[model samples]
Target: MADIARRPFLRHLRAETTSYVQHLRNGEVRHAGAGIAFWFRPATAALAEVPLDDREQTLLFHARTADFQDVTVQATVSVRAVEPALAATRIDFGIDPRTGRWRAAPLEVLGGLLTELAQQPALDLLATLGMAEALARGLAPVRDRIAEALAADPRLAERGLAVTDVRVVAIRTDPEVERALQTETRERVQQEADRATYERRAVAVERERAIAENELANQIELARR
Candidate 1:
């Protein structure tokens, strides 16, 4: 029998396109996908593939407002890879073939941190603290926990993925709470105005009484003379 050539099945695969990869000065990473893109501040067309070991890390966080019920927010986090040379061997962020989106193992670690933040008291989280600063403080404990988790992962340890920063983006506040605050402010202002009016009237009355007494004393002195 003559040798026959067998045809191989060809599967259609789509080529991936890269878009909106930002390397911020604060050692943060931002990869914007299809719906949105980042205009890299202070730089243009500087998008480059983060070496496997040096690729940025990303995390998703969810938080709820205590003052306002049913209010929740989602944040996307990205961190720069500490060791560029060992990135490929240490961290395996599976990039989506079609979207060129990068996914890191520490994402779960981020989730755990977010979980802790969500469980915290809402009043304390929002008290006198800027939303972003409060969130950063809340995530500090998680950052330590993430360091420990990454250290345990042999692959992660090789590339030194440091948790440099935790940012809280797209924070949401409750409409009802905002309205209440406004109302309270207006009431306070009105009260202050009313108090000022009473004080001015009292001063005028005292001045008028002093003038009348002076006139009476002048007439008595004239009569005595």
Candidate 2:
């Protein structure tokens, strides 16, 4: 990442293969592309570097379900700059001439953008479903819904960003709610187990009665003989 060296009034810039470097001199593009190096005067040149590699951002947020149940959503969104030139224009990917580092946090800006874009659809979808339904069918549906929303949003295209993948890691309620649900499930399982045990005992008793009756009939036959 140390791709810049300070020269006497000039700076030497080297770009990585994963980064798209744009060199602007007096409001015109002098050089642009990935993995290209150039020297420019510090006073007159503006440099912008946009990373083209895919990045995964972890997102955690809260949403309310249709039944007014509050749940936390954890997700990961994979994204990349599809058009580096346009991205450089949209976001402040500009780097200081002295250091090959961004003057501002461009990636953070992208993260905020992605978080908003991903959260809205999830909120809307969860709002339409109850907590049970959301927990039961939320993972795939939420992931797909977010993917669809990101893919269809024109803002991303205009900003030269694209969503590569979306994954819903977890949708969980509060600890108290979670414990209550767990208790309910556990009780249901215990009831089923008890029923099964009772049925097994009943079958054993019936089998024993049939065996005893058969033995008695055999003894009576012997007595008659």
Candidate 3:
């Protein structure tokens, strides 16, 4: 919704339900709250808007495993601003009263911070595991590690941000490496199958030999009788 209406020299501003707005005049806060409506002089008013709704950020990055193999990590992180006042102070959420648009990209700055925090723990964990181990068991452990780091980081709390959830979707190696592993597995399976077939044929030949010997013994006894 268009929250700003212009009439004469005064601009009426109404904040969105998901947004928390802070209005300041003469270096003092005049109004501060969510979904607030007020009128102010554009030249004398300073405005800041912080989003209170939860947002999900997708992250994709590469890391090296213990075996010196490179792998890609895909993850999603859910976050929200808890304190509008603190968040505004930490980042440039200031907007022009006349245009009602932010003077800076605050969300991009937050996303960059989150990406750095999430990547650190994940990279540390992957560096300790081999490629196969990372692919097999790295997802949950990486997710937990990132979650713990984000939750415990003082910077996030100071900025009035909270990490609601962390999910690691996949840990994958290079395509050529994956294909090589698959080929090795397929060869092992084929060898086992061949061995089983040989054993079954040997058992059938032994049974036939025993049956022929029993028939020859019976014929000899009948001739003697």
TM-score of each: 0.42, 0.93, 0.83
lDDT of each: 0.43, 0.92, 0.90
Encode model 1's per-residue lDDT on 63-155: one tens digit a residue: 443323333334333444555434433434344332344555444553454344333433335444454343335344434444444434454
Ranking of predictions according to lDDT: 2, 3, 1
TM-score, ranked from best to worst: 2, 3, 1
The prediction achieving the highest lDDT against the true structure is 2
> Against the true structure, candidate 2 has what lDDT?
0.92
Deviation (Å) of 105 in candidate 1: 9.9
Candidate 3 residue 160 Cα shift, in angstroms, is 0.5
Q: Which segments of model 3 are wrong by more than 4 Å?
A: 188-225
lDDT by residue for model 3 over 1-225, one digit each (tens)?
228899999999999989999989998999898989999999899899998999788888999999899999999999999988999889888988878899888888888899999898999999999988898788899999999999999999999999988999898888999898779879999999999999999999999999999999999999999
Q: Best TM-score goes to which candidate? A: 2
